[model samples]
Target: MAAISEALTLSAGALEVVLAPAIGGSVGAMRWHGIDLMRRLSDDDRDAGNVLGVAMFPMVPYANRIAGNEFDFEGRRWQVLPNNPPERFNVHGSGWKQSWTVARSNAGAATLALEVTGGAEPYSYRAEQAFAVSEKGLSVTMTLTNTGPVAMPFGFGLHPWFDRDRDVTLQFSARRFHLEEPEGVSGDPITLPPELDFAKGGSLPGGWRNNDYGGWTGEAIIRYPSRGAGLRIVADPVFKHLMLYADPTKPCFCLEPQTNASGAFNRGRWNDPDEGVIVLAPGASAAGAVSFAPFALTFPAA
Candidate 1:
């Protein structure tokens, strides 16, 4: 179970971040000036160590699903068991379900590390998350190193859940949208539709929306007019894909920044630049960072 007593807290100015390293390296909560920037975990969930209830979590080795729980790489076929049940496939890899050790930490920063060799997934790698909070905002740098004996395809991403305020607005730029098949599988890419295109900023849809945005600009803005504040997401170039997930029946939504597409492994687009897959040889590493900066929202002559 996840114990809040073991969680670490970091604060700077009006921002505060609580990290539950042992709880799948997830963020228990994030607040700015006492306003929840992300979905805050409840005490019951915290005590239960429920990752799904946390504010955010890390997706290592890869993100999203691996169709049929199998794939081929380097002339070798590999298979992963169904990690998330009732889904019929492996989703989000194993990082979010494993415990992480705190390599180092201080008042304003912390680094949590995990090593997986002979895990459920046919990949062996070491992952680290370095989180730092400053007066400006919070920044998380994710690093993944292949620790196996051979080359392999790898990817990493961050999954953050945000509160779905009635007046919240989102904006970002992407070249194409990966269509969604049944059971949340990612299909082929298609031109962005008028409603799905957010280059000009807009409100969340009233229905279900779970899709990946390829060729992302690596930046996004989410505004909460009710709180008079907004957050700007700046990601590194390595993260070329952005995923938006919003269910009207839920009280929260997700904006994920990842290195590869939702089903790049299954799509067989390993070397496709637009798919954002990284073929890393043994001992090679890939790293990137994402920053969240909050700013005051300005209304016109309100």
Candidate 2:
């Protein structure tokens, strides 16, 4: 809950890195242009009030709703807790809202770990979160190892909010996409929904927008024309297969790269062939990495 320990101002480029060690492990805070790029979740602050990014995991599906919250996996019924209020469903991952321990810290990076045991029915996992800031950009890697004897289902993803405006363009290579019903309404996929279309590049006209897309090639590019700044997010091809876009009537938008659909654990639809069902044997481990590379486009000084 508390930032037990931290290290800062190291010779690691112009970026300012802060490491906080707590009971769970460690949480690394990276600052760029006075903007907290990642979501800061602590005992006091549980949301990304200032930052624009957060790595999501352990399992990010509607385990508490939609697909019925009951999955017949391997001949067993698993019941997950409902974490979402309005929709009354489970969204994102568990550890994200929980406090993490600060294990180690240096000027460059810090590692945070969280342990969850004996959760609703079949959702127990021990996870480690590592955040690093370098001259290139920010990198977050999470490793979840099943300590339980039984095989449990899980997934991993990241929620990073970016500045969205007329000058910002989001580009990524994908052959297909999935559009979700507004307000978590369950239904058939709307092929190439206007908001879900990013093939030829476009801009956010305005209003609230939230949906999921799949079939990505493991790369995302966000360009800021006015500031001449751009961020390239890359993920392990074997880790992420779906991308969620959410623009909630703000100057920012989220490009979430996920391992499976929001309800894949139960629905069993639209799962990435390359990345699906994260199963870990007792003492076995599954690790995935997400990286953000920032570049300042240079031109002749006016």
- Cα RMSD (angstroms) for every candidate in the order listed: 1.9, 4.4
Off by over 4 Å in 2: 1-11, 17-30, 33-66, 185-195, 205-207, 269-275, 299-302
Per-residue lDDT tens digits for candidate 1, residues 199-230, read 99999988899999999999999999999999
Q: Tens digits of per-residue lDDT for model 2 on 192-226? A: 55555666666654655565565677887777777
lDDT of 2 at 101: 69
The C-alpha TM-scores of every prediction are 0.97, 0.78
Instruction: Return the number of clashes found in candidate 2.
Output: 12
